[model samples]
Target: MSGLAALCFLLLQTGACGFEILGWFFRGKSLTHEDITERAILNTTVQVCRALALAEGKDFTFPPQPFTAESVAVACGASKSSKSFCKAISLIQRKNWNVDLFRFYSSRHHFDDETFIEGRKIITEGLSAVKASNKRENFEAAREKLGNILHPLQDFYSHSNWVEMGNNLPNPNLIRAGTSIGNIAGKYNVTVCLDEIEKRNA
Candidate 1:
């Protein structure tokens, strides 16, 4: 009877230890949805602000006062601006908005890689469709469509494959593409392309 009692105690202790280790592993390695949202927003905001400042011939500064999504959207959507500048603002707004929504949904549910990849493809297709529409209406439609595509991304981040999805993204070249596209689109309205051109020249 004493031997059985000792064996039971050992099993309980081993189980407790295993649970503790598993807790530590998940705590150290996993990223919460909030973490992903904040990181994406912060990174995109900084990049967008820098691009805006350069376009406007102003010195680039961090944490520009009163920065908000609405403000950014308005700045980019200005009708009086060059098409390129407007496009940059539009792109930044869309990208960040998509990421924000993606994080929000991801926090609550599971999503798969095929979903995200398919969503991206849809966004690209939508962009193509809008290019031929009336400029203002086209961009607005594109923005709306982008919001739709981001819906699934939010839920996807909650899945076990979230990290793997991030890892599978196309890398920095896409970032460069975004930047270049913004500059070209905004060039007629602002001089954001100057720095990028100088870099290419050098």
Candidate 2:
């Protein structure tokens, strides 16, 4: 199996897989913004770790279970880079996270432009780094970066109507090069309701 597929399959065993994919439906609003992003990171990390374990022909388990960014931050608190990374990760806001790259990757958006090409290049490099490296720390960093890149790709499902427009299927072209994103509009669009500043705050 491909490393990415194997990673995802293993991540599903962690229960975080369900949380990351389906939790957005029932628990999205209940989940803290950090919970949403951190869950994605945790699951993605599990996938990478599992893939590494498989490659090494060993079993693996992530301790300090129910892996939260807070727990990891505390555990790696002494490392300045880990602390900075964790802090930055916790700041993923709904409207602002991955804002720049979000527009470049879609049949609805640009259908494979410079931004899209660059994004894919980065992800391919990140995945290669994760799979080919023996350094745990480097793997962790690469996993986090890969998750960040993937965050918006997954968001493509939540943010756009490909499921409807493409007959309840995903626009597979979004992940590939030299293909149209179906008959999507010129931009990927979704109507989401955001909590506005309260009158008290105003």
Candidate 3:
């Protein structure tokens, strides 16, 4: 077996193969926003740590797959018992889930009801909020706002034609001011390949 495969086999004995286990559990089911958000969070954390390590000209060991806040904290040189970072993780996850609950009345918050432009506006404003909060050293508030925005930002891919437009990567323009996010599919207009996805879902 390869090194990663051997490690996964060992971790499996301890029930610590996080992504392996999650992949099995969610095999047939569609990923919830919480799952997606957590995965993205872990990925972002790992990439940032990698970049920082490179800048410092140091070797960086990655935390286990599907990293938790504690693991990431340790890998990034923060205390594993750090409450603030863990709290930030929980706050972000809760905010991501809350959109399904409290924000149900606002379809644009979920990129539902064909409110594409409004959803983009929420992301733009939320990004600004994150920056402003960070500027004030309100890390908790910044994380909260990040979680709030991630919901609609993620929903855009699920509910729109950014994919069918032949782009495999995320839209960079979403964060750029005054730039178009490309042509959005309207309520009256049908998004290409969306019907195929619905058919698959059904």
> How does model 1 fare in lDDT?
0.38
Of the candidates numbered 1 and 2, which has the greater TM-score value? 2
Worst 10 residues of 2 by lDDT: 10-19
Query: What TM-score would every model get versus the actual structure?
Result: 0.35, 0.41, 0.72
Q: Model 1, which residues run further than 4 Å from truth?
A: 1-46, 64-67, 70-120, 130-137, 160-202
Ranking by TM-score: 3, 2, 1
Candidate with top TM-score is 3
Backbone clash pairs in model 3 (N, Cα, C under 3 Å; residues 3+ apart or in different chains), count: 0
Q: Candidate 3: where are CA atoms >4 Å away?
A: 1-28, 185-202
CA RMSD for every model? 24.2, 11.5, 10.1
Please provide, for model 2 over 16-117, each residue's C-alpha lDDT reduced to its tens digit, 9 standing for 90 to 100: 211232333445534432354566555655556566677988876554878765554444333345665565454443322343346433533221323444
Error of 1 at 67 (Å): 4.8
- Models ranked on lDDT: 3, 2, 1
In model 2, what is the error at residue 106, expressed in angstroms? 14
